[model samples]
Structure formats: C-alpha cells, structure tokens
Target: MTLPFYLRGLLLLTLIGCGWLLWQDTSDDLDSAPTAVVARPTEPAAPPSPVAATASVVDLFPAQTWTPAPPPTPVDTSPPKPPPLPFTVSAQWRFENQSKIVVLHGNGNQYTLCNRCSIPGRIVPGKMLDAHYRLDKLTDTTVVLTYMPLKHASTLRLDTH
Candidate 1:
C-alpha cells in the first residue's frame, strides 16, 4: 500500500533533520580535538625601586582611622496607641427606661449598639471583644468607645438622620 502524500513528506523531513543534527555533532567533536599545552619559563619578581621604598605607609596601605559611629538613634519608649475608630454614629435613640441604642454606620455595615456593650464583629483578630473595643458610654447625642488594647477612646456624635 502506498503512503499518503503528507505522511511521506513528513517522514522525509524527519530523516533529513536527524541526519543534519548527527552531522553537526560529529563536526563539533572533530573541531574540538585537544591540543598540546606549551609551558614558558617564569622570571623572578623584580625588587622594589627607591621611590617605592620612600613612599608613605599610608600610600602603600591606607591607614584605617577609628571613627566613632553616630550615637545610637533614640528609640521611642512610649506605649503604642490604637488605630482610629472606623465607626460613625448614623442615628441614636433613648427610651424612658434609660436604655440607649445607637446605629453605627461604618465600613459599609450598620451596627446596632447598646449602652455598655461590645460592638458586633471584630475590629482586629485574635482579641476579645472588650480588648478590641467597648461601648464605654452612650449619651443622647454622643457615643464613647474605648479601644482597650491601647486605652484609646473615640467619640462619635449621633446624627438625627
């Protein structure tokens, strides 16, 4: 059976490619044949001249003077402060029973916060609610939140809307 035209052409090309590669490898091996190494006599180093002998020690080898490093920069020893509060009071309500509630709209969510309570969700991971933040106080027009980790307090005024 006769092979298809495309198959015959492919076989011919493969054979030619393999032969070319073999030829290239053999040619490279012949060209890289090792040659003999020839050694030349080495002369002794010349002695230093009078001018070089009279040169200053600093010229031959630089003098390394002791330089006192700049005094260690002062480090801040104060305790770290908490980051700014991300919440803002959007609305607030107070009942006759003295209970207060506020709607805090921040970070794209509304938090219904009551007096002396922790905010829902975490401001930081791996921390208790009280350690992360506390609703320290709630007034008719303002809310006080204390970030216990750094003892930082932030006040948000309630808006009528």
Candidate 2:
C-alpha cells in the first residue's frame, strides 16, 4: 500500500542519484537495498545508471564517447662525462715543503702541481680529472679543480693514508 519513510527516501534518492553520478562519492553505499514484500515496480524500473541508460535522459543527447590524449614523453638533456683518473694525487701537510707543491704520482711521471694551476693532460689517468680544471684548492682528503671556460669545478677525493 504505502512505503516506509526510509524506503520512500531511498527511492527518491535513487532517482536523484542517477542524475548526479559523476559528482557523488557513492563508494559507501550498500550494493543492494533491503526490499519489502509489497514493494513492486509501478512502471518498468528506471534504467540502472546514466552510463547504462536505455530510454532515459542520457538517450536524449548524442552518445558521449571521450578518449583522453596520451601524455607527452620526456627528453634527457645532459652532457656525457669522461672516465675517472686513477693516479695518486696528494696535497696533504707536505703541500708546502718549500714551494707549495702537490704531488701527482702515476703514468711514469711525477707532477709537482701548485694551487691555481693545471696539469698538462699527458700523465693524468683516463683523463677523467682533466688538466683543464686548474688545481684551485687542496686539503688533506680532497682536491678542488676549477674548469676555466665555464668556471665549473670538480673534486678529486683521495683515499685515507
């Protein structure tokens, strides 16, 4: 005969919810509503959803088909680096024995380098630590070299001795 308040509200809500499907967070709703024995459809049941509308308002407009464009790909923009040198270069407490020289020992030659000066590239191993970057500064465990053209700097970390 007549629906209970919650059942009538549920039916009214079901009618309203179909129109607002895109804006509703209906994730918490129960899959099926509790049915009463006399609760039968007066007319044919409303189409289940906007997406599945057979003769509902959704059918009044052209079929809505949307395909999102693919995202753009990324490009890498970096210069290739040279291999690392393996020579032993030291600027420890002996940097200023008498003439502020840092010792480079390898490649059958020993270079006595001073701060703010560069090597000649002949004796540097693998040439990773290029002669272009001057021996700018030195400490017990590291050497700082400045690349003149770009003012870019590089480091040579020495193994503990």
Candidate 3:
C-alpha cells in the first residue's frame, strides 16, 4: 500500500489501542491488593539542648525586658534656714565689763537680766516665754537664744523686720 495509507492505519490503531486500555477493568486491580502509605511526623524527635546557648524570649525583646533606673534621690534645695524663731530682739546693751546682766530694749520695753532668763522675766515674746532659754551666742548686732532643756535655738537681730 501507499506510505500515507500505512501512516493513517498506524494512527487509527494507536487511538483504538489507547481507548481499549482506558476502558479495561481497573476493578480487578482494586480487588487484588492495597499498598501501605506512611504519614510524616510534624514534631521533632529530641528535646532542645540546654548547653547550646540559644537566644531566649528576653533576648528577642530586649526593650520589653529592659527597665529604667529610678530617678536620682532628690537633693535638699532649700536655703540655709534662718535660726528657729522663738523670740526676736530689737536692741540690746551689755553692762560695762559685765556679762551677768544685759539691758535689752525690745517688744517696746526695757529688760534687765542675766544671760539665762525664764518666761515672764525678760523681753521675750509669746505667753510661752516662761520657758527658760539661755543666751548661747551674742553679738553687737545679733543674739542667739537657746532653750537649755530642748537645745533648740532662735536668732534675734537688732531689726525686728
């Protein structure tokens, strides 16, 4: 026969052969056997090593883990205080070459007394002036009066203002 006829016959035979194979019974194979198929595991087989020096959750978020130090302790930022205020002196005069008695003009009065004087005695102020206080330090311009029992002191100056 011709080459074209032979080629056409070959093509027709190939199509018929493929169609026959596809139409054949796969039911026989299904009834024959079923091979096993294994499933993969999702987790690791071993635990992590502690000595590996792995990065930690803290390391991942250093900013979250970090904390700022407390603010520095507050410094004392007030003036050296004027001496404790108990009483104030307006003027004072010491007897010539004598420390025993001093003449003080204050609180609109003249008081004559020794270094240590008690309440209702000197030119001291307040109803509590009965509380005794001693002259701890005295100058021409100022006087430091100290309560002997309490050890608390007040500075009195020449100018009440």
Candidate 4:
C-alpha cells in the first residue's frame, strides 16, 4: 500500500534537511585554527679612531735700498767759422760756348758778376774793364780769394793760406 501523500512529502523534506546539516558540519571541520608564535634576542658593537697634522710657516726680513746715477754735458758743434769768406776775392769767367761767370771782390771794394760775363754795369771795382778783359787772380783765402782769365780758357785752382 502507499503512504498518504502528505506524509510522504514530510519525509522527503526531513531527509533533505538532515543531509544539508551533515554537509555543513563537515565543511566546518575542514577549516583550520590559527597557531601562536614566540620570541628571540640579538647582539652588539664596534669602534675605531684618530689622525692629525699638516704644517706651514715662513718669515725672513730684507726689502730694497740702493742708489747712483748722474753724468752728461759737453757740446760745441764747430761750423760757425764760415762767414768770414764773404770774399777776400772771387772770380770765375767761363766761355767756350760762352756763359759761366762769377766775379766778386769783397773787402769793401765790392764787385760782383755772375750772369756769364758781358759785364757792362753793376760789378764794381772801378767797373773792372767795363766788365771783363782780365782779372785773373785765384785763391787767397783769409776767407776766399779766387780769379780766372787766360784768354778765357777756364779752370784754375789755387789755395794760398
């Protein structure tokens, strides 16, 4: 025969409940509990040191003193003795194609000609032959004396003190 429907239902339900409880219990048991830990002690130390000295020192006295310098003065150039030769005599007559003349007779009797002789006026010394025909006399320096004329063949040199 068969259980009445209601009862069957109840039974099924109870079984299911019990199965679930059992599964729960097993799962709980599998989870582990925590463990506790204890302590330990440690160690120490070290030391080292010292180094010194780097040196410098200097001093010695002596600073400058000394003197000497002086000498220079002497000068007289020598060339101012040439003004006296303004003519103690001077003469130059040249012609060989005619033209080269200088006639100066100084010492205050003054005569001059340097325009190449054809002497006609302005060459004193009694107008010297109206200017040239003979005035030969060269070099007599107490400061200049010179002359020339040998038919006008020019070139004469004389140096009588």
Query: Residue 12, candidate 4: how far off, in angstroms?
Result: 0.5
Off by over 4 Å in 2: 1-66, 76-100, 105-110, 115-131, 158-161
Give the Cα lDDT of each candidate: 0.70, 0.57, 0.56, 0.46
Candidate 4 lands at a TM-score of 0.21
What is the clash count of model 4?
A: 4
Q: For model 2, how does the per-residue alpha-carbon lDDT over 29-134 read when each residue is reduced to its tens digit?
A: 5445555677667899776785556555453576656987679887777755544444576443343343234577655656555443354532222223345545
lDDT order, best first, reads 1, 2, 3, 4
lDDT measured at residue 82 in model 4 versus the true structure, 0 to 100: 19
What value does the lDDT take at residue 91 in candidate 3?
41
Runs in model 4 lying further than 4 Å from the true structure: 33-161
Instruction: Return the top candidate by lDDT.
Output: 1
Q: After superposition, how far is residue 121 of candidate 4 from its true place, in Å?
A: 99
Best by TM-score: 1
Could you tell me which 10 consecutive residues in candidate 4 have the lowest summed lDDT?
Answer: 141-150
lDDT of 4 by residue, 8-105 (tens): 99999999999999999988877754456674546444332222222232335646566554466667886333122334336554557554445545
Q: Looking at candidate 2, what is the lDDT of residue 157?
A: 76
Clash list (residue pairs), candidate 2: none
1-161, model 1: which lDDT tens digit per residue? 99999999999999999999999999999999899999785987788887777774456676786997789999999888778788776766666655567777766676676654455652322232343666766676677788876778778777643
Between candidates 1 and 4, name the one with more favorable TM-score: 1
